[model samples]
Target chain A: MDLAPLALSLQVAVLATLVAAIAGVGLATLLATARFPGRDLVDVLATAPMVLPPTVLGYYLLVALGRHAALGRAFEAVFGTPIVFTRVGAVVAASVGALPLVVKSSRAALEGVDATLVQAARTLGAAPARAFVTVQLPLAARGIVASLMLAFARSLGDFGITLMVAGDIPGETQTASLALYDAIQEHREAAALEMALTLTAVAIAILYGVGKLTARSARGA
Target chain B: MAPDGDRPSLHVRARVVASHAFALDVAFDAPPGVTVLFGPSGSGKSTTLAAIAGLTRPAAGRIALGDEAWFDADARIDVAVHRRGVAYVFQSLALFPHMTAAENVAYGVSRALTPEARGERVRALLGRLRVAHLSTRRPATLSGGEAQRVALARALATEPRVVLLDEPLNALDRSLRRELAGELREALGQLGVPVVFVTHQSEEARALGERLVVLEAGRVTHVGTVRDVDDAP
Candidate 1:
C-alpha cells in the first residue's frame, strides 16, 4: 500500500516521456523527409531498442553512460554525480525503451501529411523549417499526440532496463514495477496485486486514448 | 529585341530525365501577362512550372526572370524555392486545411509589413477574390469555386515575381470554370508579373491565355500568340 514507489514511477515516466517525445519527433521528421547517406542505417539503429532484448539494451546504456565513460565523466563534472544508479538513470532507461514507439508512430503520422501542402507553403515564401512548423507539424499533430501517449505508457511500465540501469534502491529508485517484483518476492500478495492492477488500468486508459486519437485522425484523413 | 523589353519575362530551358521512362526537354519564354502552358496529360506541364518555381531540379536548364537567374545548371546556381519569390497555385489547390481562408491567405503576406498592414492586405485580397464572406471558414467548408478563389488569393498575397497556376480551374464545373477563368484572367492581368497557367483544356487556355506554349511528349511543340497557335495547321 506504500505510495512512494508509484509517485517515483510517475515522476520518472513523465520526464522519460518528455525526453522520448522530443528526440522521437526530431528523428521521425528527419526520417520522413530527408534523404541522406545511411538514412536507413540511422532508422535501424533508432528502432533497434524495440526488438533488442532489454538486458542487452541495458548493457549498452551502462557501457555508454557508466562512470568510466566520457559521458558519465562529463555528467559528474557538471552535476557532481554519476548518471547511473539514479532516478535520472531510470528516466534514461525508460526513454530509450519508449523512443522507437514514438519514432515509428510519429514518422507514419508526419509522412501522412499531404506533400502538396508543404510545397504550397514553400511557394508562399515559407522557408522549409517554417513550412514544417506551420503546416506539417499542425497537420500531423493528432497522430503525434497519440505517439506521445503510447510512449508515456511504455515509459510507465518499463522494468528490465530500469532495473539494470537504475538499481532498485529503496525509497530512492524503487519504481512501481521494481517494487511490485520486491513485493511478490517477499510474499506480499495484496500489495503485489494492487500494484499490478493499478499499472494495468493506467496502461489501458492511455491505450484507449491513443486508439481514439488514431481513429479520429484516420477519419479526418 | 523583344517588343516588351522593359517587362520581366520568364525564360526557361530545361532537360529533365524523369522516372518511368519519362523525359522533359523544353524551352520557351513567358512575357509579362498570362502565358498558358497548354498540354495533354503526361506532357510535363506541371513539371515545367515546378522547375520554374524551383520545386523540381532540371538536369540541364536556365530559368531566368528578366535579369535575375533563378536556376542555371551550367552556373550551378539555383535559388531556393521560397527565395525565388514564385507564387504557385497547385493543381490540388493545396490550401492549409487547418487554417481559415483568411489565415491561409495571410500566411504568405510579407513579414516586413506591420501587423495592421498585414491584416489589411489579407482583407483586401480576400475581398478582391470575392471570398471575403468566407474568410473564417476552413477549406473543407468551402465549395470548389470558393476554394479555388481562396487559393488564387493566397498565391497573389505573396506579391511574387512570377505566378504559376497549374490547372487551377479544372476541378470546377464547366460554368464555374468559365466564370472563374474571366476573374482569374482579370486578377492575373493586374499583377503585371509573368504568369504561367497550365491546362490541358484548350478552351481554358484560350479564355485566359495571351500567349500559348504547346507541349507534346515533354517538348515545346509550338510557342506563339494564342490566335496563331489556334490557326496553325
Candidate 2:
C-alpha cells in the first residue's frame, strides 16, 4: 500500500526487463540467423519458458539461488552475500520467468526480414556483419521493441517468482505485487485497490506507447 | 578481364541444393556482353543468378573470372559475395526503404573513392539511368521504374566484374517492361561488363542477350546465340 514498496517493485521490473530483453534478443538473433547443429534445439530451449508454468520457473530459481544451492554459494563467495531473499534475487527470478516472451517475439520479428533483402545487401558488397547491422537489425527493430515492452509488462506484475525467490522482503524486495498481497492479507481493501489501479494504468500507458511506436516503424518502412 | 578475348568474363559450374524444394545444377558462361538466362517459372533461373552472385553456394563446382578464379573445387576457394566483385539486381529491386537513392548507390563503392567522387558517381549513375530527379528520395516513395534504377545504380556503383540481374523487369507492367528493356540493354552495354540476366520472357531474353542460355528443369538446355534459340523453337 505504501509507495516505497511499489517504487522498489517498479525498479526491479525495469532492470529485469532490460536484462531479459537484451539476452532474449541476442539469443533469438542467433536462433533466427545462424545455422548451427543444435540451433533448433536452442530455439526450443528459449521457447520452453513461454509454455512452462511461471511457478515452475520460480521453483527452479528457488533451487538455484537458495542459500544451500551452488549458485547461491558462488554469489555469496563473490559478493559476500546471497542473492535469494534480496532484491537481486527478485530480478533474476523475474528475468528467468519472462525470458521466453522476449525470445519468441524477437525471433518472429527477425524471421520476418526478407531473405531477398539480405541477398540484395550481399550483392551490394556488404559484409555479413555490415549487412546485419544495416539491413536485418533495422528491419527487426519493431519486433525487438514489442518484445521489450511485453517483457516489461510481464516483469511489472510478476508475483509468484518474486515471492519464491526474494521472499518478499519489505522495503528492499517487497514490490507492488507483494504489497498488494500483504494489504489483502491484512484486510486493507482500500490500500490494495489503490495500488492495483495505479499499476494497471501505468502498464496500459507504457504498452500503448510501445505499440504505437512499432506501428509507426512498420508504416515508415 | 576476359583475357583470352574469345572466352567469357565469367564462368560457373556448380550444383546448389535447397531443402526438398530446389537444386540448381548447371554450368554457364557470360562473355563481355549481355548474356541472358531464360526459363519458365520454378525453372531455377533466379537460383542460377544467385549462385553466380555468390549468394548461394553450389554443392561442388568451380566459378572463375577471365583470368582469376572466384571459386575452385580442388582448392576449395569460395569467395564471399561482396569480395567476389559481382553485383546482383534482385527481382524486387530490394532497395533500402530507409536510405535515399544516392546513399543506396554509394553503398557499393569502397573507401577508394572520395566522398565527393562517390556523390558524383551516384549522381552520374542516377542521371545515366534517367532517375536523377529521384536521387534524394527513398525507395518507399519512388515509382517502380525509379526503384529499379536505384537498384541498378547500386549494382553498377560497385564496378563489379560481372552483373547478375534476376527478372529485372518482372515487376513492371507490360508497357513499362518494354520501354525499360531497351534502356536496360543500353545501360548494360555501357557498363562494359559481363551480364548474367535472368528472364521468364523468351522475347526479353532474345532481345537483350548476345548469347542465350536456356534452362529447363535445373539443367542447361542450350548455350548459343539468340539465333540458335530461334531455330529450336
Q: What is the TM-score of chain B alone in each candidate?
A: 0.96, 0.93
lDDT of 1: 0.93
lDDT of 1 by residue, A1-221 (tens): 89999999999999999999999999999999899999999999999999999999999999999999999899989999888999989999999999999999999999999999999999999999999999999999999999999999999999999988998998988999999999999999999999999999999999999999999898774
For candidate 2, what is the TM-score?
0.93
Q: Write down the C-alpha DockQ for each prediction.
A: 0.91, 0.73
Question: What does candidate 2's lDDT look like per residue over B178-202, in tens digits?
Answer: 8888988998988777888888787
lDDT (10s digit) by residue, model 1, range B17-98? 8876899999999888999888789999999998998899999989998878899999999999999999999999999989
CA lDDT, every prediction? 0.93, 0.84
Q: Give TM per candidate.
A: 0.96, 0.93
The residue-level lDDT of candidate 2 at B128 comes to 90
lDDT of 2 at B126: 90
State how far residue B196 of model 1 sits from its true place (Å): 0.9
Residue A165 CA error for candidate 1 (Å)? Answer: 0.6
